[model samples]
Target chain A: MEATTEARVPQKLTSKGRATRARILEHAAELIYTKGVHATNNEQLRRAAGVSGSQLNHYFPTKESLVLAVIEWQAERVLAFHRSERFAHFESLDSLREWAGFYIAYEHSYREGCTLGSLASEIIKTDLDVRADLANAFEQWKDLFRDGLERMQRLGRISAEADPARLAHLLLSAFQGGMLLAQVARDITPLEDALRAAIDHVQTFAVLPAADAPEDR
Target chain B: MEATTEARVPQKLTSKGRATRARILEHAAELIYTKGVHATNNEQLRRAAGVSGSQLNHYFPTKESLVLAVIEWQAERVLAFHRSERFAHFESLDSLREWAGFYIAYEHSYREGCTLGSLASEIIKTDLDVRADLANAFEQWKDLFRDGLERMQRLGRISAEADPARLAHLLLSAFQGGMLLAQVARDITPLEDALRAAIDHVQTFAVLPAADAPEDR
Candidate 1:
C-alpha cells in the first residue's frame, strides 16, 4: 500500500473547500458556546455547518481537534475585540459607562456571551489541554487591559499607583460572573445589573490622579 | 442472607466512626480545592483521609453526593464567616483593606480554600442538578453580602444611596476574579494585588451620604 509515492501524497484543496472549512469552525464555535464542547460532537457539527459527513471527517479526524480549532477562533475574536482601541477611546468614567452599556447589551444578546470563558469552565470537567489553552487566552486578555491601564496612568488619566492588571482581572471576572448568573436565571437582568453596577464602581472608585486629563487619545 | 431479628438495621455505634466521616469530608475539600473536584475521587479521598474504602463509602455513597456534602459544609462555613458584626467589623475601606489581606492569605492557605466555589466552576460543565445547586449557592452568598452591606448602610456607615445588593455582586465577582487569576498561576499574587486595589478603591471613594437620607433597609 505504501509502494507508490504519488498515491500516498495529499492533494491541495480548492478555495471553496478552504472556505467550507472556515465555515465549519464558525458553526462549531456557536455550538461549543451554547452546548459546551463535550456535548457537541461531529454529527451535530456537520448538521449545524450544512456540510456532508465525509467533509467533516476529512477536515477534523476527531472532535477534540475541531474543538481546539473553535477555541483558537474564539481566542482570536476576543483578543481582537479587546485590542480594537475600545478601551482606549474612553474619555472618562462617563464615557466608559456609555461603552459598558453598549458592551453589556451587545454581549448578552449576541456572540454566545463568551466562548472562551465557557470553554474554560466546561473543560474543567474534561480536557487538560483545552483548559490550558483557555487559561492562556485569559492571560492574554488581562495583558491587554494591563497595557491600556498603564498608558492611562502615564498620561495622568489614572493614578500613578493604579493597578491596571487588577482592574483588568476584575473586568473579566465581572463578565464571567454575569454569564454564570444569567445562565442560571435564563434572564439577562443579572448580567445587565451586574455590568451596570460593576462599571459604576470602577468609575467612581478607579483612581484618576490628574484634574485635567485629555479628552482625545 | 437472612437478617437477625431487629438488627439487620445496623447499630448507631461509635463516635470514632462518625469522626472518620468528618475527616474524610475535610480532606475531600482539600483535594477539591487544590487538584479540583473532577480530579478527586473516592480512593484518593479515602487515602488522604486515612480512612478505609468501606468507611468512605458508608459516609459518602457516591462521588457526586460527597462533593455535594463538601459544598454544604462550605456553605455553612462561608455563611458563618460573613455573619453580621463578624464581617461588619470591616466598616470603612481602610478596615476593608486589612480584611482583604487576611481574606486572601487565609484563602490561599486555608487547607483547600473555597470548596463550594471550586465545585461550582467545575460543575458548570455538567449536570442540571449540579448547576442548580451552584446557582442556589451563589444567590445565597450574594444575599449574605447584601445583608451585611445593608446593615452598614443602616448604621450610617455607608452611603444611603448605595445599592447594597449591587455592591455585593461587584465584591463577590472581584473576589472570584482574584481567585481565578491565582488559580491559573497556582499562587496567591493575583489575588493579593487585586483585592488590595479593590479594597483601597472602596475605602477612598465609597463615602457615606448625610444622615438625612432614608435608610435602605
Candidate 2:
C-alpha cells in the first residue's frame, strides 16, 4: 500500500509513546511473519497492532519502513539468542559441532525457518529499500561466525590458510540453504547433512601439530 | 485466487489446444520469473499468453494448477539443460569443478536467481499443494548430482565410504544458499566461495593411489 503525501514519521516520542511504538512493531512483525509482506496490508497492521491509523502513520510513514524495522528486530533477536548461548565463542572444533547440533535441534523445534531469511527471500526482488537492511543483517550474522573462526586461528586451532571471512560466508550460505531445504521437505536431514559437511570442511583446516601425531613403533 | 466451484481442467484437448497450453505455460513462467507468483494475476497471464478467459480456464482451472505446471516446466527445463551439458556424468573431480565453474558463470550472467528456488522460497510457507511440487523438483535436481557421484564411486574415483546421496544433497544445499546470497548482494563472490568450498569438500573423498603421493627426498 502506498503512503499518503502527508505521511511522516514522528520526530520524537514520550516514554508512553515509545511503549506504544514497540507494541505496534511487535504486532506488525508477527503479522508480516505469518502473512507475507505483500499480503499484509496497512489495514491489517492497524487491526493487529490495535493502533489508530494516525498512530501507525506516525511511527512508519510507509509500509517499507515498517518492514525494514521488522527485519532489524528479527536480526537482533536471532543474534542475541545465539550470543546468549556462546554461539560466537567457537573455541575449537568441538564448539562448532555443538553449535551445529543446537542449530539443528532449534530448527526442528521451531519449524518456521529463519525470520530474516524468509523475509529476505520474499522481498529480495521487489523491494530495493529493504535489501540494504537484509544484507546488513546477513553480514552481522556472518560476522559472528567470522569472529569465532578468527579467534580459533589466533589460538592455533585453525590453520593460517583458512580465510575466516570466506569460510564464514560459506558456512552461512550452507546454513540458509539447509534451513530452506529442511523447511520445504519437512525433514531435518538436509539441514543436518549440509551443516555437518560444512563443519567437517572446517575441521580439515585444524592445525594438528607434529607433537599430536602418534609415534611409530 | 481460489478456484470457482464450476472450474474444471478439461479432460482432453486437440493438438492445437495443447500447443496453446504450452504457450500459456511458457508465458506464465516468464511473467512469474519477472513479477513473482503472488504479484502476477490471471489478467496479466491472459494478456501475456494472448489467451481468452475460456481458453485459460480450459487449460488451468485454478492459479494453483498453473503454478504447479510452471514448477514442473522449470524442473524439466533445468534438468534438460544440465543433461545436455553432461551434468549427470561426474566421472572425475575435474568434472565437478567444471560443473561448478559453469554454474557460477550462469548465475552471474542471469541476474535473476534460480527460478524454482525463488518460487519455492516465496510459496513454501503458505501453500501446501505447491510445496510438494517444489520438493519434487528439488529432489530431481539433487538426483542428477547423486547419480553422478554414484557413478564416480562405482568407477573407483571416489572412496566407498563417501555417500553419494549425502554429498549430492550437501552440494545442492550450498548451491541454493550461494545463489540466494549472490542474488541479494548483487555480487558473485558468495556463489564463487560457496561452490569452491563444496567442490573442495567433495575432493576430500577422492580415492588417491599410493603411487600418486609425492616421494620424500
Give the Cα lDDT of each candidate: 0.63, 0.77
TM-score of chain B of each: 0.75, 0.86
Judged by DockQ cut-offs, the docking class of candidate 2 is medium
Which residue runs does candidate 1 get wrong by more than 4 Å? A1-17, A20-24, A41-67, A83-95, A106-113, A124-127, A130-132, A147-162, A184-190, A205-217, B1-24, B41-64, B84-89, B106-114, B185-189, B205-217
Per residue, candidate 1 scores C-alpha lDDT tens digits across B1-217 of 0122113213674678666767887898778767776677777887899888888878777777777667766766666666546456455554556556666777463323345654565555554355555566678777866776676777667667777776666666566655655665556766666566545444443544555446743
Query: How much DockQ does model 1 earn?
Result: 0.25
lDDT of 2 at A13: 71
The lowest-lDDT stretch of 10 consecutive residues in candidate 1 chain A is A1-10
Instruction: Tell me the fnat of candidate 1.
Output: 0.27
Per-residue lDDT of candidate 1, residues A84-140 (tens digit): 666454435655565557656674433244567656655544535565665677788
DockQ for all models: 0.25, 0.60
